[model samples]
Target chain A: MSVKLAGELQSGNVIIVENNPVVVLKAQYNKSGRNSAVVKVRMKNLMTERISEAIYKADEKLEGVMLERKDCTYSYYAAPMQVFVDSEFNPYEIHEETLADITKYLIPDMTDVCEVTFYEGRPISVLLPKTIIREVEYTEPVVRGDTSGKITKTAVLKHTKHELQVSGFVEIGDKIEIDTETGDFKKRIA
Target chain B: MRRWDLFCRVVDNYGDIGICWRLARQLADHDGEGEIHVRLWVDDLESFAKLCPAIAPRSPVQAVGSVEVCHWSTNFPSVDPADVVIEAFACELPLTYIAAMARRPTPPVWINLEYLSAEDWVEDCHLLPSPHPTSPLKKYFFFPGFTSRTGGLLRERDLMSTRVAFDAAAEAVFWQSIGIPPRGNEDLRVSLFCYENSAVPEFLQSCVEGPTPIRVLTAPGAATEQVSRWLGRGLVTGELVRVGALAVHAIPFLSQDDYDWLLWSCDVNFVRGEDSFVRAQWAQRPFVWQIYPQDKDAHFVKLGAFLSRFLHGVSEPTVISDCWQAWNGRGRISFAWPNYVANLAEIRRYGEVWACQLDHAEDLANNLIRFVREQV
Candidate 1:
């Protein structure tokens, strides 16, 4: 167990609350008017897969549940669980509920190495690669004089059907790099 | 009676204790169904005494009205946790007290009552729960705000009606009570309560050179000192120093109730921090706020958020926003003052409209009661 301030805690970090190990899916820190700050987090329980949102003082000390993580590749998806295989072909089944966020970016046979976190050797969550390149399945035609990237329009990803904002210059079938954590367009692939 | 412990640590100004005391008194007065016996635990009683004369600084425990006030010492007393616990402004609760709370059969409804902000994020974060890491306890984050989604501003039950009933005769009495002569209609009366800022001299200079005769009442301590520095002379309580059209009077530090009266009596109010700022709004007067400055100019964002809400539907919002920015060290008060003063009538009328609009929000104390009832 390791101690971390609530403000320092980030996504993919597992924290112990009420004897349960919960992985943070997202964290947002906001400074109050004076002398204090607050951190709001969305987390999911490793054992029960119970998703919950909580707020904590930025300076609040929290116990982090250290978990073993292994680099793995997405192999397949069983009915209620997504399966990942390590280099040695060791299969780990993570609940589909736990993949609620990363599922949009998950693709079988993807070359990126995803990190699989385990508690007591039970696979809990998968951390996607920091940035992912995906082809824009569909978007409007490029608008004139929009090369400055000030304007943005929604574009749908090819395989995942995930729609995200892209620069106005981006057109259908254009590949863009997206920040996996925020799901924001990083840059357009030439 | 359902008991509550409101813990407040006075960091620098009286804003912390002022707000806590107001909430405690309001909660004590408006115990809707069951009695909510509020105990305000303050670290600095000397400061608390300034706001409420009834508070005995040396006493360990004393009752002021229905609320019980306790001196929160470094050596904390071993007391049972209340049914509901509020740590005001994120002041950490004593570890021993938290331990006692954890021992309770059904853990107390713990709340970290945050500072007031008009920012959009406040609504999303308000009333959210924070589960304790090791203990079987949860604390909720309650934020006071201008909107209905967030816990509203602090307002006493009779505050509005009381202000409305304070007629010109009552105003004359208030002036006499404060050692000031009756205010003439020609003199634009303004109350100044703020932290030290670079804009003070410029503001004072503007009043001195402006066409309108302005009478500035500087609240004791920092505000008075600032005015004195600008005057190149020390100020004594009740001493009026005249410079051109600007006449500055240094008033003694007043009780919380009297301070509210000061805001109500003023044509324009300059308020700082949390408590006085809220009171200025309830006063329904054209006011300039100097938000408690933070590192990296973060407070400007908060000020902008409030200005956006306050300036809604107003013609020429910059007239107010510019003066506010200048007062906050962003622009020149000399340039903004003319625009601000020229529109005082419009601003004053809008102040009434703004206060009435804010009235629609649930009062902070009542909001806490409804939230607590739902939880415990």
Candidate 2:
């Protein structure tokens, strides 16, 4: 059975291949002049984490990759890692390497659902939000009439309980969103 | 082989005309089966003459190496119809030329040579064809890019050998001849040629404060003036200054070959816009790029895309990315120079590797021959 789902595909969505679920690591739309469009995707094995690339023809009918995302609350750390509880009260402990890049976005006692990529009931990779709200620590004074647009100043970021200064265009107390994948400021949250 | 007429309108710079002139020369010199005759039509002969020096301004058409240089003016020339026509950088071809191409027995190949980019989409769009609405001519989009799948970089045949044989002592003598003395010990020699930038103050500050000494060589422009204003003193005509540990040297304007030598001889080259940036890659040195700023911040996306590809295999990719971003952001120079200095060895290795990779790609002249042959 085949189904088509139309939305921006998030990284780590699990697709069935040879009756097994494979986790996607990246997805980008490939477009060309008068040529058929394709979703150029790279995926990693859920168990092995080995990456592979695949192209899905745009007009072709393909099986829909279904994934499950749940809202969860962070709980106490479980030695060398952190644990969280889903809405169904299921506890999931993730390794330090699994949450390596996005750990800075995590805040204890905060309730947010981690979208887990599942393949026949096994957890794969995690997909983080496009932007994360963080408080800025320091910024240089903005100058006037110098809008030649060729220079960037560095700024620091300070969370409520921790401080991590990043080099970017930001000001003190500005709630900026950081791309979990690229670790860049996406936008300033209103 | 298709006979192509490449039209170059020099926008008061040698770089633009220099590139087109080189391409035209390459096309004419091709030894393949099909004959390719290129008529290089240039608006500014004066600027072009500076690069070649042998170009006779009085002659309507003169042979320079292999290509025939035509003095393009308000009035178009009555010439044999070419099999292909190229409008460099979207420069409009003369109406007479356009009409001639339209009336040719077999419509000529029309191409709009686009600016180079490392963006993901460029690969997909490169060489895609567009039909002229009125004329039978079909125009192809030729994009100069860093990949095998795209039109390759503008490289001369002897470029690498020439760069290798370029005498350092001779270059020092040339600098002295142009009224700039040899750099002092502990000086970070820098060459600056760019559009007016607001980041000049911060860049100057960084140069003045960095652990290493800096000797900045500027082209004749507002960038020199900006440096002068920042120092609170007009550049002392012939002497270097001790601004902290940095020694800033202001040099005179250089010819194209001299500029290439400057790039080859410097610790860091801050190049603005197109031509010099490409040359810096050939220089095989660590560099900071100042992209031509766009109205809607589109250049930011272009800059980021390039950085993403350039730093793909680099050690301390984050630092390189940070330095590039800081260089292009709003007057922020705190991060780049310090981080870059700390990672000099790694950066230099990456530069060397990148230059070798670029060398494997076919040069502009050879690429033009192949492109024309396929189209014809």
Candidate 3:
């Protein structure tokens, strides 16, 4: 169902645009000294694959979009697309183009549910978990008292039969959080 | 070519006005024959006058090179419409100017030149466009970045040549003329200028304890207060004190040109905030960056990204990394200082190479000319 916003939404706010819920990418707060504030929000249109930035008065209120989440199991990769089976055993396929950046984190039958974006009753995008536990392929041997500043090294990720190369310093067999959003290693989880 | 107007509100700092002045001068100088006429509207004409003595603050309008420097007032002037307009660092253009641009035949190339960043997404987001709802204006996002895909850093032609001809003896005489003493042989000459940072004490102690003497040239501001507190005595012009092996020299306030020379002359520069940081990079010397701290320590990520790219090929990467982290953390300065100094030669070479690479990027003025030509 199409949802209309009550007022203006700030940038970075996840909202319903048309029938699809999208995130506000940027918000410019324009107000002179002692003047009323106005917010100009730049939004990414999830369903149509376009971006539109609009301005609104600061006092304007925006309607929050309702997003639905469900438990799903990873089925298999079809070249660039990733397929997932929900609780009803219904298969939802996401194009490889959309999931290509975060595809390395998807492990089959792992039971981790994914967040799917729906617009106008059609899936538009997906949001991955902030951190994914992955095995470290390689890390330099840690030296004691050698906290020689800002160390960054590459590591590989091994998930069952799937092997992926990631960069960060962590020992082999160590599980670290890989932030799919930025493609940077967060930290060692366990 | 699109006619562009760059509005700079200099907030009393020479660096801010200095940068904007360079951008304006270069834009006008190079784009004279092109379709661009860059009208530089600055609030602080007095500060702008300090950089280029040719600027007559009394004159409401005066020409310096190709740039038309106007004494900016609250009331915007009515002028012919331009093809492009820029608001530096999100500074608000006069409402009248915006209204006029909205009334233009063809919408101007509106841009908000954002501060420099090293974050990963900046590459993708740089040069993105945003449309004005009420007006037909479409403002493009221009982010100054370390990477090539982004709008490059501001570096003027003859900057290197000017830096290269910096004579040490002449600099000493110039300082002496200003009543500052000659540099001590053993002192590690440093230029101190930054925002308030918690790590200042530890960093100071490390400099004090280091084998070589540290001669610090203090800028007026929080750094001046810091130097005063560290010495437990008020600083006067040309005052020198021996703390351990370090001989801290507090010099008088310098003009913008002298500041550039100081960066070129110093063994290491401790520069904080955006303007000095860019100047330090252009100096081609081994320097430590004290990033402006933010909530949630977001500056750490920016600092990390820059260090990772900056020290990518250095020998003994770990030592360099640790030193940078220690300085940034404002912890254990004693440990980091020695390692940093030992690799000074190599780091200097690396910095020079990096500066050379950055020089390859189009100067902001030249880029503006090219941008204006293509659009017009």
Candidate 4:
């Protein structure tokens, strides 16, 4: 179904804009007159993995792309493809290329109970939890008196190898909750 | 000089065609023309013909001056896309036409012209590209805004100079042509053009009982209908009705240019929608806007944004703001009119300075042409 009024488009709405599947990152509505109403949206192309902005009339209809979401658990990697299975153990294979940049966060054993999206019978992408707990892979010893995490120091995540910023008090063996969306360090647990 | 295909769908009334027609004429009337071709495809010719009298409502293709207006139907035939394809107001082009565009050795420069806005975000979204998934083609979003970063408002080459040279003698002749008797300086000569507003009856009542006599020139639409509903009779062209100090003379539907003249001659213009609102600005007259009501009180925000920006530096913003609020059903217009009418001198001067400020921004057609030039 078409999304009525571009103003109704919300974050996470998958729409076909310019024939490409895109997820709306943000939707902002601004009208300056009765007949002059518009909605400006920032969208990320699911295929090309590029961020772009577009404007639409407030009442303009947008074609939406429907995708099925399933709760799944990461099992193992089958070379260029990462394997996942549901609670019922129905196995699914998704291409490493399809996962795009998110593949770096796919810790096969630790990142469990993830959401996989199916489009036209193929797993196109994975939705990461807002926050995830990952063990620190490497970081220099905490700098003395640099206790405040407000200003972060660089640390790498175990298995994923994704670099994260954490407090100077954190050590290489510490486990920290990291926000997946912004990739910001949330809290540490020794 | 290149072929330009402009597509417009009349979503409401004349606004869509009015804008498309103006842009088409401006593009075709390029300086030192290298023989360019412009084709305007409109889905509704009846509404388009209302704005452009030269159009034949039933004709599939009608040549009006330098531009060819085509009646766009559902069964749109596949044709070669122009060097520049403008989908006005994001009216999606025909699927076949889009397919044809992608097949070209070099695809046409596609533009999705957005609605005009005074919002801050318009600047960031202007000229951003929407790359097509299936085809190796990209369409740019064009935002019409009050700022130079935007595509700017639609204006013609001679619009300002012609408005500047408008003669008082000619204005008097115009009043005579419209069956309006010579006016007294004390009488408030007003042009009433708005959507169906419930506040109008109260406004009429205010004009009737007010101390100063008022002469109203109204077209045959919402405002006129409201007046007629109050009078309990349909108002005909040239028919005059007087109740207390308020006297209204019904006028025939004026063409776009004549409408601008009407704004120019009137003491105040009550304009609605996009086209007339913009014209009211260029006319350099104190005007009140009755924005079209939206689904969820959205129009109020738009009204506020415009009012805040437009009246920011005016001498007495409160007087104008109070009247605008009253006009849009925020308060009783009767109470607001006394103070609003008192500040006419400031408003008129403010209008001139404001128009001068806006005149510096790039006009829509010129900006569009410049943007297209870089792409091709």
Candidate 5:
């Protein structure tokens, strides 16, 4: 399949650029008076694991690349490598750098199922669960007279040590659900 | 010397040809050691002739002023691409011509000129490159906007100076030639041009019952038809329809320069679309814009965004904002007319200041030439 016009381009789509498969990470589209629009994208090179930027006419067609996915469970992290085991007990090790932004949300020693994407027999990327429950490690007390949740404060996840912006009322040791893609706090479990 | 090819598709209106003609004229008239060559290919010569009278509607090729006007035909012609190829309004170039472009040792600098908008996001996307998915070519996106970060509005070299030196005697002669009598201070003059909207009937009623009398100079188009229907009478060119204090004159469409003078002479202006909207702003008068409505009220967002920037820091914005809103069918002009008329002085002065501020930004034609020079 092919995507024509950069205006329709979105993140998570795999597009072939110069014969190399690149995963779109971010796409920004701009339209002028009455002319053709433009799309600027930040992509990850699946072949070499390098990051690159491309800008193109929003209407230019791009050949798309399809990836195979396998359901896998995260086992543990060994220094710079994170290991996951598939249903058939095959172990796949992904480098910390290869994990890109998803490494911050991976729960070590947990059995959470993840979707591993493969391009030509090599694991290219991993998709985490939509929402994950975690314990808050630390957060400052809400300001006096500011009881509204509209104002947010930063808090850390206990096991992952990843920073998450939560409502003002969020306290230390609170169990909250977070969205992995948006990094937004979804709801409080406890 | 750089040669430029500007391709335009009429898209049911004369605006596409209007902007392209202006840019072509500007580039072809540039005074440089190496004169620039401009070849303009328009799909609809009839629409082009409406804005530019020099064009012979039936001719396949004609020398119209500084540029060579080519009546774009269905059959592709074998020709070499110019140093710069502009896809105006996203109307794609001929595949055969593009194939020719790719075969050249150094491909042309292709630029896709996008629509105009004041939204902050335009700045970030301006000048971004889109490479041909298969062909070894890259095209840049040029966005025309009010801010310095984006390509500026289209303004000719001597437009302001010519306006400054305009003779009042000549203006009076022009008015007589257009069949409109001289205006008195008490009789507020107005030029009406707009798209069809449901709110026009109420607007005409407000004008008829208003405190002061107004003489409206209207061109023959959707606006004239609407007003004729409201009065239950037929209106022909050079005829006037009078009811109570409102008098609507059916005037023929003037040429571009004459249209500018019309905007200048009027105390207030009602303009539409991208070309005349920008011209009205530069005319430095209190004007109302009837945005080309889009599906799902998308144009309202564009109207509101422009108003937010145009009315920034003004002490009172309701009279002007409400009037514009009413003109766009978001509100009622009849309800906002009294206050709008009362605050005309303030709005007129603010318009001048806004125009002055916009004049400081780089003009579109100049910016385009600079970009071309860099590429070629």
Candidate 6:
């Protein structure tokens, strides 16, 4: 186990809590006024499969449980489970429920590799690449003179049907780069 | 009855001890729930003594009123853990004391009492639990705030009543006690308390040159230091320095309750840091705040968040905003002074409305008790 500051905690990092390993699904850092910084996390217990939310002082120390991970491509889903094939064509299955919010971004046979995390030799969580390019399936007509990206409108992604906010300059069939971790629109891809 | 151990480490100024002492006093003096026993452990008793004169600075262990005070040291003694433990302002708890808490049959409810903020995120973070890295203990973060969704600001039970009861005779007596002469009806009574800022001299010069006479009651320490530097002499307690229409009176350090009286009597208050800032709001008087500066100008964002909520309904909020920003070293005081002074009567009436709105929320001490009870 390696020591990690709570402020540095990112999605897919597993840490020990109450003698149980929990994978962080989301982490948010906020600092206001003269108050000490804090990190709020949404995590699920690996052993108990229980979801819980917690907050910690930004500088708080925690024991990070190192997990084995492999770069893999998303394969076809099999009902309750999602399948992935590693570089050596090794197949691994993780529960669709465990994927949480990431399920909205998953597309089969994608070129970009996703990370599959293993805890005690058992597949647990999947972490997507930092950025993913997806085409807009539907959105309102682009507004003129909005090059600054200050104006935003919701757009539906082509394959996943996932809806997210995009710059007002984007329209149907426009490819956009999105930050996978935050699911926020990054930039318009030519 | 539940017992609570409150640990406070004075980082620099008296703000830390001032807040901890107020919370500790209120927790101990609570009338209901079988009377909780509170023990406040402070590292700087000298600073604590300034707020409560009864505290013996050198004593390793002592009692002030119903609450016990301990001089926290490197060689912390072994003692049984209380039912609840409060780490004020995110101060780390002694490892040994934490171990004692873990060893207890039922571990204490650990809480990290965070600093006050008006930002929206405070509500989202308030009352969230943080599990210990190795131990089984969990500590919750409690934030003091102006809104109901967050843990509310600190206010003693009889504070409002006491302010209401303080009449003109009482105000005169308080002025006599502080060794200040009577002021003219036209004179604006201002209480100044703040940290080091380049804006201080300019603000003082503006006050001196202004047409209206302003009686500036400067609190000892930072406020007095600023006045002394401006006068090019050492200014002591009870010393009065006059220039133009401004009369600066250096007052000695006042106890906590007396400080409340000072805020109540003043026409305008210039307060710094957490304790006095919250007290000035409770005083229901027009006031200006000088927030403790933070790295990379982050404090400006905090100041804006508070001002947005504070000046929500005002027609020309910039009157207060510009003056406050200038006082905090953003713009020119001379430019903001005219508009700010013109809106004084409106702001004074607005202060009463704002205080009434704040009073609707549950106070910090009671909210803490409720949150702890629900958790434990």
True interface contacts reproduced, per candidate: 0.81, 0.02, 0.04, 0.51, 0.38, 0.68
Residue B219 displacement in candidate 3 (angstroms): 1.4
Query: Over the stretch A69-114, how does candidate 6's per-residue lDDT look in tens digits?
Result: 8888998899899998898888898888888878888876678788
Model 3 chain B: lowest-lDDT 10 consecutive positions? B128-137
Q: What is the TM-score of chain B alone in each candidate?
A: 0.99, 0.90, 0.89, 0.96, 0.97, 0.98
User: Candidate 2 on B313-351: residue-level lDDT in tens?
Assistant: 775787667766677774356766687777876887798
| DockQ (Cα-based) for each candidate | 0.75, 0.02, 0.08, 0.29, 0.43, 0.63
Could you say which candidate leads in lDDT?
A: 1
Model 5, residue A183: distance off in Å is: 3.6
Candidate 5, position B169, lDDT: 78
Q: Could you tell which candidate, 2 or 4, scores higher by TM-score?
A: 4
Flag regions of model 4 displaced more than 4 Å.
A1-50, A55-190, B32-35
What shift in Å separates residue B49 of candidate 5 from its native position after superposition? 0.7
Interface RMSD values for all candidates: 1.1, 15.0, 9.0, 3.8, 3.3, 1.8
Task: Report the lDDT tens digits of candidate 1 across residue range B107-161.
Answer: 9999999999999999999999998777898989999999999999999888889
- Using TM-score, give the best candidate's number: 1
Better of 2 and 3 by DockQ: 3
Model 6, B29-112: lDDT tens per residue? Answer: 876576789999999899889889999999999989999999999999999989989999888989899989999999899999
In the predicted model 2, the residue pairs found to clash are A151-B329, A151-B330, A151-B331, A152-B329, A152-B332, B188-B213
Scoring model 1 with DockQ, what do you get? Answer: 0.75
Total clashing pairs in model 6: 0
Q: lDDT of model 2 at residue B174?
A: 68
Sorted by DockQ (best first), the order is 1, 6, 5, 4, 3, 2
Q: Looking at candidate 6, what is the lDDT of residue A75? A: 88
Model 6 stretches astray by more than 4 angstroms? A32-35, A142-152, A167-171, A181-190
lDDT computed for candidate 1: 0.90
| Top DockQ prediction, candidate number | 1
